[model samples]
Target: MQDNKIKQEIEDVELIIGKIMQIGVLIAGAVLIVGVVALLVQGDGGYAAGAHPSRPLAILAGVAAFKPYAIMMLGIFLLILTPVLRVVVSIYAFIKENDKLYAWITTVVLVILVIAMLIGYFGK
Candidate 1:
């Protein structure tokens, strides 16, 4: 009886995690789309002020801004798969009630993405 109760609790936790992941993916997708549209509106050139953003500092700043938006799009792409992974992990966790490895994995991927974005932005 105690084991059955534990199993039920685990399933509930997994269901909640899966739902959270789905919501996260949806939110990420929305942000990605909005960011892309904003970037596109900016055009290939500099600001609308007609200053034509020259100089190393200007270029770096421009790239830094651009990279994050681009990376967000990548996140949108990943989110599509991530939610699926989350669902699968959630199921596994429910069955086994093991360590929270999948959560950590998701966080690590996000961190790596952010770091890559920073490097792309600043390295430019």
Candidate 2:
């Protein structure tokens, strides 16, 4: 009947959403791994430290010369954003169905990413 068809469609949609979530988790994991590898491959941040410009006012121009610094900052931002997005998604998922494990795992990954980013950012 019409009710059965609607139920089947809902189930299909849920299945697709679940697959997308799994893919998202994998992507986040991959980004974390790549960030670690980058840290290891490039010591000293893999870019020139802020160099003094010829002009006295050039100190503020460090952003232009510090390519690695910019990249590092971008990675750090991504690390932070990932967790924030995960939290939002996790809350919605929790509302639909009370599951804490996914939220916890996302949080743990976020923490680790933040720590690694800090170490890399400061260690540079």
Per-residue C-alpha lDDT of model 1 across residues 13-123, encoded as one tens digit per residue: 767776878787887687667556765776533355434333345544654676434434454555655665665555456346555676566556666766775686678
Q: Give lDDT tens digits, candidate 2, residues 39-89.
A: 566655444566422222232243345434344444444444554565555
Let me know the TM-score candidate 1 reaches against the reference structure. Answer: 0.44
Q: What are the C-alpha RMSDs, in order, of all predicted structures?
A: 8.1, 9.7
- TM-score, one value per model: 0.44, 0.40
**Steric clash pairs (candidate 2):** none
Q: Residue 115, candidate 2: how far off, in angstroms?
A: 26
In model 2, state the lDDT of residue 62. Answer: 31
Q: After superposition, how far is residue 66 of candidate 1 from its true place, in Å?
A: 4.7
